[model samples]
Target: MAKTVVITGGVSGMGLSASKLFLSKGWNVMIADFNKELGEKVYKELSSKYSKKQVAFQQTDVSNATSVTDLKTKTSQLFGKVDSVINNAGIFTKGALHEVAEDAWDRIMAIDVKSVYLMTKAFVPDMIEQKAGTIVNTASISGLTGDYNMAAYNAAKGALVNLVRAMALDYGKYGIRVNNINPGPTMTPMFKANPQSVIDTFKKASPLGKLAEPDDIARVMYFLASDESNPITGENIPVSAGFEIYSGQPVQK
Candidate 1:
């Protein structure tokens, strides 16, 4: 029998890549994302290529507890049980601390931090009951270090990093494993959404000549989700391609 996995924000970017990888690995993937149309399209694309039993999608807004609950219920109905979850739904905010709007900060926190809490709350019980599961959260390098004009995103991701550790400790005895991946300058939609000047500055700051692709992040997520990492838990693994170790330095002109 195929393992069942639920992925939040699986419609695009890193989540989408992870969904594809899991499907390739013979897991039944239940994708949850806010964009109903895109989610449906991706589901169709995957289902057309694979068996319908291997992939599905549920429209979800992870920031809403009700929606997350519905996602959990629907996923269980679609696929008997969920063996793993990827809490990858997140939003980014960039601005000077004083200039950042309160609503923007709240939105970022709600999606990046609160969503993890909600999803874990909704789905972890099943894992605990079954005495086996894995959780992979998408944090950011900003959470480990810091960067200018990313106060809210940094703070929320940092909170998520610690949350993963606490959950790992709390659930380890139940055979549940929790971990986080901190990606740096990934070439996702969020990265491209930044101002060109901001993007240029970030490009110059990284030791690597290019930003990471979504696959780079997704591959690490795959490892953490699989039994291959059965012994690993509570780890804040960095997928930054040496960017995490670089000191601030201007790119050579």
Candidate 2:
């Protein structure tokens, strides 16, 4: 049977990379993203190279329940069924807790934490009915530990990690596996938004001596969603190139 996977934020960055990888693995991809422009472009680009039936694009606002509901409906109509879902939509907020605006914190929670809940609420039932499925959440190194000026991002991702654990506990009996992928300083648009000095410092400090590529994280996501990782559930797999080993050390850059 052909597998189907839905990836939120699938238009760019790791999400886009994962989308492509999923297709190459013989799974149909429903590219769900808030960026309509990128979404359509990816859909068209992939359609040009593969069977149109193997790919789709849906503009999704994962933070909004109504939007997610509609996304689920349309995705079902287009793909018939979904075998896995990657909650990869997220935003970055930088500032001390005391200085961060309340709105910024809420936005982070909505897109990062609440979006996971909404995706689960909307998709888990179908997965339960099928009795076999996987859910992959995109967390961050900030979730495992913390970074300066990232109070909102850290809190939201921390909640996301715990949520994966809770989901695994509740749904394991139904054969549904839930896991989190914690990426470190990947070269995504989000990271590129930072100044070059900031980027250089993080790259030099990483044990790998460079920021991770989107494909680096995408491969792990694919593995977790594949049968190869059937025994692994509720695991927080860090793909951060040893960022945790010396998170306390300052890069001399």
Per-candidate TM equals 0.93, 0.95
- Relative to the unseen true structure, what is the C-alpha lDDT of residue 56 in candidate 2, on a scale of 0 to 100? 93
- Write candidate 1's Cα lDDT for 34-149 as tens digits: 99999999999999998887899899989998999899888888898889999999888889889899999999989999999899999999999999999999998888988888
**Candidate 1 clashing pairs, residues 3+ apart or interchain:** none
TM-score of 2: 0.95
* Candidate 2 Cα misplacement greater than 4 A, ranges: 193-195, 247-253
lDDT of each: 0.90, 0.92
Assess the local accuracy of residue 133 in candidate 2 as a C-alpha lDDT between 0 and 100. Answer: 93
How many clashing residue pairs are found in candidate 2? 0
